[model samples]
Target: MKTLLSAIILLSSVSAFANCPEFKVPKKFMARESLFSSRATDMTFDAGGNRIAKIEERLLSATTTFDLYDNKRQKIATARQRMFSGGTEIEIKDCAGKIIGKIKERVFHNMFDIYSKYSILDATGKVIAESEKKEILAPSFSVTGTNGKQLMKMRLSTFSTRSLDEWVVEILNDTQADPRILLMIPAFKTSADNRETEK
Candidate 1:
């Protein structure tokens, strides 16, 4: 049943983005495990292996700051998370430094890190989408729209190795969601899980 559902999502994603050539529909993206050293995450194309977007973390800062860039290395969006906060809060902005969206972590079943929830908000602080971590052995997340409709499903690719990990972003619905938001889902999972271990 899971495999069938995944196949349906793949077909829907390809069909929905087929007409839109301008936006690149990302199949998978790599996020490095940056714990001690400062490293950046890059989302690349599978065909030519060209980088489509990059996420960089700031050095020696109290709060976590991330800069998102495009293929041309142009700044597209930025995410900032404050330190010493109970709940995780990340603010996303456009290249012009305008607020675009925010990701707020929500409380869920705290038993064995099996469940988690996050709310994605637009500039006006309206909930545009919501993400929930699936309770499975392999890492997976389900993104739903404001109307409680599933929009996308992100799964950590099985081809991931020790050096790098890839996340497959599959669009499930016809709704157009910002790719940057989709990219941030796995990143949040990594960071949030790390936080839980520290406690």
Candidate 2:
């Protein structure tokens, strides 16, 4: 059943953004996992199916780490989710190891919102964005910037989300935010949920 669903997701994702030769997708693209993919790695591809980046997830020292790579296989960024201390934050760093952004869990903030709420922070550790999952009429996930603009939107191929390890991402065309940081949000959120489930 899982394999069948994975195949469906693959088909939906491919069919979603194909047949447009004039459409050039660089920033606006999808990051997806291989069919029958485990939770180990994911590949980012443009609409033409050209590889943009690759993210590898690993467990190290009680922390879940996701390393991003370019098509050339050069490391670009890293996201680390600290499992200890209730796994409050996931830190994103550039290849230089400098912190670029963070995904923070909000415990008190959840009281007001039916869905889980998260704060996105820049390198300075200042909260600069917000994310919420909406399942109203159209089930979608959106990350909003400080200016109250949607940074990116992630929606599943099917209405049901089979796994957090895989996704269909579409970064808004007009967003001025860094794409590197935005891409890390999904993995961090997945790690956050894993931490919660373990508890």
Candidate 3:
């Protein structure tokens, strides 16, 4: 009876929140950030739990993959993706809810409202690495070293917006860098709609 009661109380505390939990995600582990009000644009976690697939309003699409590492650092499973834009460019993100690192020429305009990428770190806030977006043909990248510490490199072939239908983005391996990965937290936008509410 005591254990059951304790579980009930714990669940009650978790359920008590302004917004319902999303992505079957735990409040403590899930990192939330937003570009506009009323929408949690992104979330990130260090571990994997559930398998999810969703379609958001923006042109943003996703392909999910995972890298399984054993006792020794070995590439087990690699998540690969191919994302494109809608009529106009929107946000592109990873499964963990972070933005792509390098935005292309055409989509650069839309990135103003998005966080490009971030660093995974240790307890002391030292960066483990960082992630950003890239294209395969134009420039391909990966994390090529051991765990805890890794190196990321980006190469851009050329910049052009001639056709306008072009879109390919990848998450840059960002475990070793400065200015640690900025995890976005949902906040209010300085739009005319919210200006009245602020005052």
> What TM-score, over all chains together, does every model reach?
0.71, 0.67, 0.22
Local distance difference test values of all predictions, in order: 0.65, 0.63, 0.28
List model 3 lDDT by residue over 1-199, tens digit each.
9999999998886556222223222222221122322422222223234322212112124432222222133222222223355211112333333443321212222543422333334334443444443433442323222364335433322432322111122223443322112221111111111333445
Q: Mind giving the per-residue lDDT tens digits that candidate 2 earns over 1-199?
A: 9999999998987675343222123645665654223334444544557777766778676667888777777677788876434326778877767777887765433434445466788888888888876535544578888888887788655523444435577767465345666777655555445545556
RMSD from true fold, candidate 1: 14.2
Best by lDDT: 1
Question: After aligning candidate 2 to the native by TM-score, how far in Å is the CA of 72 from where it should be?
Answer: 1.0
Per-residue C-alpha lDDT of model 1 across residues 1-199, encoded as one tens digit per residue: 9999999999997676443223355444444444534233333433236566666666334676776766677667778875435467888876656676888876566657657688888788888888887756877788899888988887777876544556676677755456665666676566555545556
Candidate 2 lDDT score at position 25: 32
Q: How does candidate 3 score on lDDT?
A: 0.28
Clashing pairs in 1: none
Q: Which sections of candidate 3 miss by over 4 Å? A: 1-11, 15-118, 122-124, 130-136, 139-141, 144-199
Off by over 4 Å in 1: 1-48, 83-86, 110-113, 194-199
RMSD per candidate (Å) reads 14.2, 13.8, 15.2
lDDT of 3 at 13: 67
Clashing residue pairs for model 2 = none
